[model samples]
Target: MDSKIPQIIRKSFIKEIIKKHSNIKVQSGVIDLLSECTTVSVSYISTICNAICNRKGKKAIGDEEVIEVLSKMDNEFILNMFEELRK
Candidate 1:
């Protein structure tokens, strides 16, 4: 897997999300840190999804696998999903 994160999850996107959620002024260094952290987190999640696929004898990771991994990793993830669904 490439160490380079996708453009979709770049610093600008992180800034946008943070801007939407909080009113505090975020420094460039903080945005950069968040971007890097997001990249690492996505990579880790992908790794877990891939491992689940391997265990299930599947060649591709699907939404179900990713959801399962997320649910196991964080209950808040499932709560967030429910919140979105409610919205």
Candidate 2:
């Protein structure tokens, strides 16, 4: 998946998330680095999702696949966070 993640997530959205969650001010440079890291992480997950889909002979990527990947990676904290977000 060589697709651009910029279309899906942007720096402004990241800034908004930070602002919403924290009172500490963040520098533009740090925000830029975070944005880049977020992009890379999302891309990596997307790649894994694609591979999982291929192995399953599936044509789509959904939350189940994402949760499965996270579970396999033992990301219980993130999974729990997401589960809370759903409520």
**TM-score on alpha carbons, each prediction:** 0.74, 0.81
As a TM-score, model 1 comes out at: 0.74
Q: lDDT tens digits, residues 1-87, model 1? A: 354546445977887888899999988888778877877877988999999899999999877776777788886866587558756
Instruction: Give the top-scoring candidate (lDDT).
Output: 2
Distance (Å) between predicted and true CA of 40, model 1?
1.0
The lDDT of each candidate is 0.80, 0.84
Q: lDDT score, residue 45, model 1?
A: 82
Residue 51 error, candidate 1, Å: 1.0
**Candidate 2: deviation at residue 66, Å?**
0.4
Clashes of 2: 0
User: Per-prediction count of colliding residue pairs?
Assistant: 0, 0
The pairs that clash in candidate 1 are none
Could you tell me the lDDT of residue 16 within candidate 2? 89
